[model samples]
Target: MLEDQANDPAIVDQVLEKSGLSRDDLTSATYSAQKEALFVRFACDVLADATFAARAGLQFKSSSSLTAYISKYSRDLKQVLENASRFHGLIDPALMFSLRVAGNFAAIEAEWKDASYARYHRRTEFLLFAGLARLRDLTQSNFFPIEIRFQHEVGSSRNKYQRLAGFPVLFGAERVEIVLALSSLDLPVPTYDPKLREHLLEYGDRVIAEKRQPKQKLRAQVEGLITRSLPGAIIQSEDAAANLGLSARTFARRLKEEGTSYREIVEDLRCDLAQTFITNGMPLSEIAFSLGYADQPAFSTAFKRWTGQAPSAFRSRLDVSAKA
Candidate 1:
C-alpha cells in the first residue's frame, strides 16, 4: 500500500534498502528493527501526513497470503478472529489479537508483543484501519465498530480518524482495541466451507510451525527437517546434521551452544504434536505413528512422561472440558 501511495514507487524500495531490509523480508515471520524503522520514516518523514497510516490502512484489501487464507476458510467473524489470533504470527510477529467480551461489547484487542514497535502510533493506526478494512471485506458488512480505543493520546489526527471510521474514536484508553456489539461476531462469511476450513486450518498450523522458527537458527532448521520427515522414518541426528551439511561433532557443539540438543528437540516436537493430535481427536495409534513412534505403548509411555497422564485419560479430560 505504501508503494502504491508513494509519489515514486521506487522510493519505497529505496527506503526499505536504506532501513537494511529486503523486499522478501516483508512477508517473513521474523521481526526486524530495520523494517519497523522503514514504516516510521515513511509515515513521519516522507508522507508527512499524520493520518497517512489510517488512510493507507483503510485502502488495504486482503491481498496477503494469511488474509487470503482467513477469507476463504473462516465461517464468520468469530472464526476470523480465532484464526487471526492463532496464526497472526505468520504475518505480524510483533502484535497479537485476542477476543474479549464485556457485557454487550465484543472487542478485538490488539496487543503489542514488541514494545519498541508499539511505540510508533502511526504503525498502530495503520494496523487498526487495515484490520477494520479486512473484517468489513470478510463479513460483507459496512458497519463500523461501536468505538475504537487507543493507548496513545489523540493528537491532531482525531478528526481525520473520526471521518475515516464514521464512529467514536477514543484516545488514551487502557488498551488499543476495536469494540463492536456482541451480535456482530455471528455474521456469516460468504465463503465459509466446513471441510475446506478444517483442511486450511491444519495447513495454517503447519505453516505457522515452520515460519515461527528463526530463519537461519540451527535448532529451527533441525525442527523443520524433523517436521517434514515425520510419519516416515524419523531422521536421526547424524542424518539431520548431514542434511544441513554440518559434521556430527560440529552439529552437536552448535546445538549445545544454542542450549538444546537433537534428542531434546525431538522430544519437545513430539510433545507439542501429541497435544495437538489429542485436541483434534486423532486416534492414539495414529498419533503415535504420526510422531514416528514404533507402537502405541511407546508413544503412550513417552506422552505420560511428558504430561504425567495416559493418552486415554488426557483425551477424556479434553472431552469433558469441551462439554463444559
Candidate 2:
C-alpha cells in the first residue's frame, strides 16, 4: 500500500472543506498530530465513492509520520509493537488495537466501534492496512503477516489488499485481524538508530501531552452525535445526552462550559445541511423532513432567518446562477 502511493491532496482538501474543516486545520496537521475526528470525517467522504475508496488507505510516507519517530527506538519488532500500541491511543480513541498470543501466530487486531463510517467496513480495513504499512516501514523488513482478515465483503480494493497484506484477504469475519508468526514479532528492525532513540521517545511524549482525548470534548461529541443522526433522525438534547451516558442537566452544563448549547448546535447543523440538500435539488418539503422539521413552513421560516430568503427562493436563485 505504501509503495503504490495514491496521493491527491486536492481531493482530500475538497472533502475537508465540505466536512466543515478550515484550511488551518489541514495545514497544521502532521503525522503525529491528533487527527481523530478529521480522519473519521475523511473516511466518510472517501467511502461514499466506490472507485476512490481504496485510496483511503493511501497516506503520506510512513517514514515521515509521527508513528515512525515513536517506534524508531525499538531494539526489535516486539518493542516496536509495544511502543506503537502505546502511542496509537493518543491518535484516536475510536480505533482499538490489541496484540494477542494465538499459539504460534500472534494476532494483530484492530476494531472500530460505532465509528463515523460504521457500516462501511472498507473504510475500517483501509485504515488498518494504512497502519500496517507504517509498521512495515518502521520495521524495515521483508516479512509479511501470514493472514489478513476483515469483517466486510470484498470491494474493488481486493487486489490492492492482496499486494500489501502479502496474503489473501479474508472477509465475513466478526472482527478485523492480521495474523503474524510469533517469530516475525521477534525479528530486529533494520532502521534502528541508537543515537536518536532516546530523543525520539522524548519527542513522542510531547506529542501525546498536547493531544486532547476526543471523548472528553463535549462540544465535539455533541457535534458528532448531531452529524451521525442527520438526514435520518431528530436529535433532541435528551437523546444526545443519553447516547453519551450523561444526564441532560450534566450534558447541558458541559456544553455551556464549551460556550454553546444543544439548540445552537442543532440550528447550525440544520442550516449547513439545508444548503447541501437544496443545492442537490431535493424538494423543500423533503429537506424539511430530513432536517427533522415538523413541516416545510417551519423549515422555510428558519431558512429565511438563516439565509435572508425562503428555501424555494434560495434554490431558484441557485438555479439561475448555475444556468448563467
Candidate 3:
C-alpha cells in the first residue's frame, strides 16, 4: 500500500518519512489509528481537492478479501451495505461511518473519531457516492440517490461534483451525510448471487459465534439499526436483533455487556433529535408526528419524560429566549 501511495504527489512524502512506516510495514505491521489519522491530515495539506476520497470509492471491487467477496455476491443492497458497515474498519479504524434509513429517506453518515481529522469530514461524506457507485457496479444497477448532503461547505465546482456523482450535492447539513430515498436502499443489486451470499452470511454467523463480540462495534451496529428504524418504525429489541441476524436474548445480553439498554439508546437519540427540531422552531405537533408519535399528547408525555418539560412549554421558552 505504501509503495503504491509513495509516488502520489497529492500526499506529503515526509509524512511517510516521519511515520516510521515503510513499504514493509504496510505488508507486515499494523499501524495505530493515530498513524492512520496523520496520513489523512497530510493528504489534506497536499491535496488540492476533497473529491479524491470520493473518487477512490469507485475503485472498490470483489477483491481478494473475504469481505469484498461477501459484498460482491450479496443477495441485496441491504446485505452489501450492512456488511460494508460491519467491515468498514478495514478502511480506517479511526472513522465511524453508517448507512441508516428513516422515514422516506436513508443517509450514509460519517465522521472521524479523532478531532484532528476534522478537515477531512467533507471528503469522507462525499465518499458516500463513491460507495454508491461501487454498489451500482456490484449490483450492475444504475441507482442514483434522491440527494446528497454534507456538513461541511463545498468549495469544489458544482459542475465537476455533478459530473463525478451524476447527482446533486447539498452541503451545510446537520451531519456529514449523504441522503437517499428509502426505496433506493431496497433495490436489488443486479449481480446478487443468493447461494454465495447466503453461504457467506451463514459463515459470518458461525465465525462471530465462535468469538467474543466487540462491544463498541456491536453498539454502533445496534445504533445504526435504531437510527434507521426511528421516525418511521417503532424500535424494538426483537426487530433490531432480527436486523443483525441475532436472537433477541443475545442482543439484549450484548447490549447489557456494553453498559447500555435498547430503551436508553432510543431515548438518547429521541432527546437529541427533539432538541434539534425544537431549536429549528418546528411545531410541537409536527415534531411529534415526525418522531413517530401517534398524537401530540403522547409525544408531549414522552417529551416530558425525555426533557422534564412539555414540548409546548419547551418551545415557548425558546420563543421567549429568541425574542429577548
lDDT of each: 0.75, 0.65, 0.63
Q: What would the TM-scores of all predictions be?
A: 0.59, 0.54, 0.51
Each model's RMSD to truth, in Å?
A: 19.3, 8.6, 12.9
Residue-pair clashes per candidate, as listed? 0, 0, 1
Q: Per-residue lDDT for 151-238 in model 1, tens only?
A: 6553344677788778998875888899989898898899898898888788887787776444457876787687657554679999
- How much lDDT does candidate 2 score? 0.65
Worst 10 residues of 1 by lDDT: 40-49
List residue ranges in candidate 3 displaced over 4 A: 1-15, 18-20, 62-65, 85-92, 95-99, 110-119, 122-129, 154-163, 206-324
Best by TM-score: 1
Best by lDDT: 1
Off by over 4 Å in 1: 1-6, 10-14, 21-37, 208-324
Model 3 residue-pair collision total: 1
Model 1 clash tally?
Answer: 0
Q: In model 1, how large is the Cα lDDT of residue 317? A: 76
Q: Could you tell me how far off, in angstroms, the CA of residue 319 lies in candidate 3 after the best superposition?
A: 44
Error of 2 at 201 (Å): 2.8
TM-score of model 3 vs. true structure: 0.51
lDDT of model 2 at position 9? 64
